[model samples]
Structures are given as C-alpha cells and as structure tokens.
Target: MARIRLTLLVREDWRDRYPAVLERCRQAGLVIERELAAVGAIAGSIDEGQLLALEAIEGISAIEPERLNTGLE
Candidate 1:
C-alpha cells in the first residue's frame, strides 16, 4: 500500500529531465499519482526509505508532503 504522498518540484531549467525523473521515482518504488504541468511538479507515493535516495537525483528542486490548500496555512 503506497500511502505516502509527496510532491516533487522540477527545476524550471531542467524540465527536459522530467522523463528521467519519472523513471527514477518508479525505480524508487513510488507510484506516481499525478503530474502538475503548469507548476512543473509531480506527485507520488513510496516507502519512507525510498524517498531519501531521491535527493541524489539532479534537477529535482524540492520534495514536499502533498496537501490541499484552503488558504489557511
């Protein structure tokens, strides 16, 4: 059960690497939930341990927990 959801920010300068990043995520055991084109981000879930390895991937700007915003944060 891939219950952990995360959002990955793709660096604007590295948009071309999106495909590679997606593959890396899958290799890390993350089930890609969605891809936000306008924001250059990707959402997915994986085991907690697999996430740490993603930091080694170039072009990934940020990895954050996914949440719905109602403007109250």
Candidate 2:
C-alpha cells in the first residue's frame, strides 16, 4: 500500500519516555520527519497498511492522517 503522512499524539504521561516511544515508532516502519516534543507530537509517514502498528505503540494517544491544505476558511 502507499505511504502517507501522519501526526502522532504522545500521551501526557508518556512524555518522559519520549525517546523510547520514538524508537518504537521507528520499529513500526515510520519514516519520522519531525519531533514536536514541546507539543507532544511526532510527524512522520508510514505505509497505509501499517497504520495499526503505529497506533499500537504504547505512548501514542492518537493518529492523524495527513490532509491536503485547501487554504480556505
């Protein structure tokens, strides 16, 4: 399946374990692009079919699929 961009929300309680969480995400096949640590977010791309593996990581609270920017209110 095609790969898609995604934003991962890190659980508040899991912030302290950010490094480990990132490692797990890599293992799940995420091509990490940015680490918004201050906001508890991680931006990356992963195979559409591998989304479940990314979501199953222990510290992730939510997964947001990338959306096109239409530049409209």
Candidate 3:
C-alpha cells in the first residue's frame, strides 16, 4: 500500500490535549507512528479519508505531509 506522511501543527498551550487528539486519530484509523512534542509535530501514515478527519480537531494549526528527502545530507 502507498503511504504518505501526515504532520499536525499544534500550539504549546494545547499540549495536554495531545492524548485526546491521538485517540481521535486512532478511531479514524490513523496510526501515529511517531510524535515530536517539542515542536508539536505528529508524523504518521494513513488513508486519504483518515487524513482528512484530522481537520475536525479544533486546535490544529496546520496539517500537511512531510517533504521527501533528496539525501543531500
């Protein structure tokens, strides 16, 4: 199956609500493969519709896919 990375931008004040958001994602069939709290970024791969479900969350500042690396590092 094709996979696409999903990133969610959250505010520092809403950090405590991360669990609820994660649960919502789980119910929507989106598995959170990785999470970075310092930067308030959540990375994961899910189906198209599942990804769209994230928009329902109130505190979500932004959501998008991570850019592919060109391996120049």
Best by lDDT: 2
RMSD of each: 2.9, 1.3, 2.6
TM-score of each: 0.77, 0.92, 0.73
Residue range 1-73, candidate 3, lDDT tens digits: 4556788877677778877676776676677888877677777777875666778776677888878789997
Question: Rank by lDDT, descending?
Answer: 2, 1, 3
Regions of candidate 3 where Cα sits further than 4 Å from its true position:
71-73
* lDDT-superior candidate, 2 or 3: 2
lDDT of 1 at 22: 75
Task: Flag regions of model 2 displaced more than 4 Å.
Answer: 71-73
Find the candidate with the highest TM-score and give its number: 2
lDDT of 3: 0.74
Q: Using alpha carbons, what is the TM-score of model 3?
A: 0.73
Model 2, span 1-73: residue lDDT tens: 9999999999999999998999999999999999988888999999999899997899999999999999997
**Tens digits of per-residue lDDT for model 1 on 1-73?**
3367888898898887788877877787778889876677888887877777777777789999878788995
Residue pairs in collision within model 3? none
Ranking of predictions according to TM-score:
2, 1, 3
Q: Would you list the C-alpha lDDT of every candidate in the order shown?
A: 0.80, 0.93, 0.74
Supply the global lDDT for candidate 1: 0.80
Task: List the lowest-lDDT window of 10 residues for candidate 1.
Answer: 1-10
